[model samples]
Target: MNIVDIIIKKKNKQELSYDELSFAFNSYLKKNIPDYQMSALLMAITINGMTMKETINLTDVFIKSGEVYKFNKKVCDKHSTGGIGDTVTFIIAPIVAALKIPMAKMSGRGLGYTGGTIDKLESIPGYKVELSKEEFYNQFNKIGLVISSQTDKLVPLDKVIYSLRDITGTTESLPLIASSIMSKKIAAGATYIVIDIKYGTGAFIKTKEEANEFSEMLNKIANHFKRKIRTIITPMDNPLSSCIGNALEVIEAMEVLKGKKSPLKEVSLEVAAHIISMAKDISVKEAKELCEEVLNKKEAYKMFEKWIITQGGDLSKIKVSDKIITLKSSVSGTISSINALNCGKLAVKLGAGRLTKESQIDYGVGIKLLKREGSKVKKGDVLAELYVNDLDIKLTDEDLKLFTIK
Candidate 1:
């Protein structure tokens, strides 16, 4: 079968036969099918779109290209499309794990504005993010929560296809996104799955309506496949929590798991309670009580620390710098708005995040706002602090334009 014919066929809005799919996948894997042809095929798929059957079949094709984990033990996991300060995974997994619910989770790195799970975990000193299949499985069995980078062997084909999608501008295709997410979760041996679909200025979907649409699509697909999945649509109009960036997020998570209360703690606790409730087959109220117990007993944080240690991460020496470069209000008044998008941009500029994949992140560098939401301020009041290596880090006057006081 000619791969070019299949590409053109897809481009023409034709549904490919199973044999054609097999041939194309084999050709791609064998390096016989070039990227340009794949790009054409992806663009076609993006526009014409795939039927649910086609999407699932594409998933099946990718699944066959690598190994899938089998826990035999009951396992559960969750994922977010990503949002500012969305550290739910770091909080929820441990809660469920403390409840003795098995959590087999894999995370990724930051691509753009959204933070990466692996990046947050790496903030802990000596924590290992890369785990082999045996290591991941063993860690899951031992700790009940194993968080690591997606294994190269687990859904290798998805990686290749995903890269193609990224460059081809086909990353936002709903079916492709759903298949990519669900396939990875399904492969990770999660008998139960909870999806946090976020939308707002900080979310990729950019609107609650769009985020909910993706949530529904994922839920429907998971149900049709008889894979139990719970999807929750959340708003990211503001930072999911106050903290944004890797190490600071870890620090913030430490506080949440330690039973501290903040906007972040509130959101994370709510999510953790819900997911833990569902994963353990308990009522929401009971799930909440359990999370409280985990936090009160400090088991959640301890489990987190344990997970870090198990992953070869050192916890003791890991610290976000206490020495901060505070940006004070030159003139204080009624604070009108904190533009999350621009603050995120400024944070990235100040080394709190990455502009590209290869960019180095300062684990110690981050942004900490002295104020959040509504606040009355005065001249000389600190608005935020830029935690960085540069002694003379400047908060550009342009960033000040985004922070307004009326």
Candidate 2:
């Protein structure tokens, strides 16, 4: 019953019952269990891992810790497990909505190297990231799409545990990660969910094997709850888009919505197609064709515009820093690679992302790729441009190492 026994039991690699899991978690939420005690249990769970039953129990505890939203209409939702230049939400939501599917998403903010959907949306002036429940419901009912920040009332337990996990180096635990993500999605009440699992240098899941394992775990949990779920594993060795900052990413998303063809658009369509298939009871191929039709006909873009206006986002006010530092090749060759992890780090250094929770984001600053992998480059050919407002932030040779040519 006590937290010490729970910590010891988990540290011994024993399975915890639902009551034990709930007791420890709820005690922590009530401040009866100190962080150090919780930290011990978390580390134990991370290293020893949790059984499926235990993980499901923990996820249920997380869900019960806060309010669970319900919608009168069936809605589809999408989530990505952190990545560089992963702006699929912007394009995917509108595409689904354009096809008359409802999508209500609760997005997060940038913490380390990855960009957040809410942060990108906020770059558009007057865009409201926090909405009351009534406002969120109204927007979903009106436009069939709404993306906003998670309210404090939803999954508050995950917030506490996630912050602890971040500092304790326990974030990579499969059970913790699955519970944290699934808790939010379940609480948000999406009837159908598509989780885009990214794996590579820029993503949390570093290898394809791990990505597959994680996806299986997700599907297992989804099945337990009887939720319709699809998990798509994608590579994140390079930026998903040519742009890697808040406002710049928003601009790139708009371009994709306007019928621009690129890898970003392809990924968006793939994810949207899955959601559409689930929501409309059609095949993914048919959903993809529908997505292409709406995107090509500018219906998705129009929906995007309408969603923005409904949420008070001003596209005209979206701007990137004009202070550009273009990185060019000193030798001619084909671009063998662009390190996504390094690109994300450089963007964070340029104030495009937050190092800490309290750190302010420089919405106008980011990186724009002029040339991608496999592109031919001559000496002095531009490889990328650093859009920055701070003149003091100078480019370094380390920054140049982001691109490899041979």
Q: Model 1: runs farther than 4 Å from truth?
A: 1-50, 161-171, 321-325, 391-405
lDDT of 2 by residue, 300-319 (tens): 99999999999998898888
**CA lDDT scores, all candidates in order:** 0.76, 0.89
Cα deviation of 37, candidate 1, in Å: 5.7
Give the CA lDDT, 0 to 100, for residue 66 in model 1.
78
The C-alpha stretches of model 2 lying farther than 4 A from their native spots are 1-5, 31-40, 164-168, 394-396
| Model 1 Cα lDDT, one tens digit per residue, 1-406 | 9978988888888888777877887578778888888778778887888776777777777677778888877778888887777788878777778878788887777645666788788788788888899988888778778888777888777767765664467756777778778878877777788888877777767787777778777877777667787877887766766677789888787788888777776666677777777776788888888888887898888888887778888867777766677778878787777666666676677676676435777777777777776788999998877777776766667865445787
What shift in Å separates residue 312 of candidate 1 from its native position after superposition? Answer: 1.6
Which candidate should be chosen as best, given TM-score against the real structure?
Answer: 2
Error of 2 at 103 (Å): 1.0
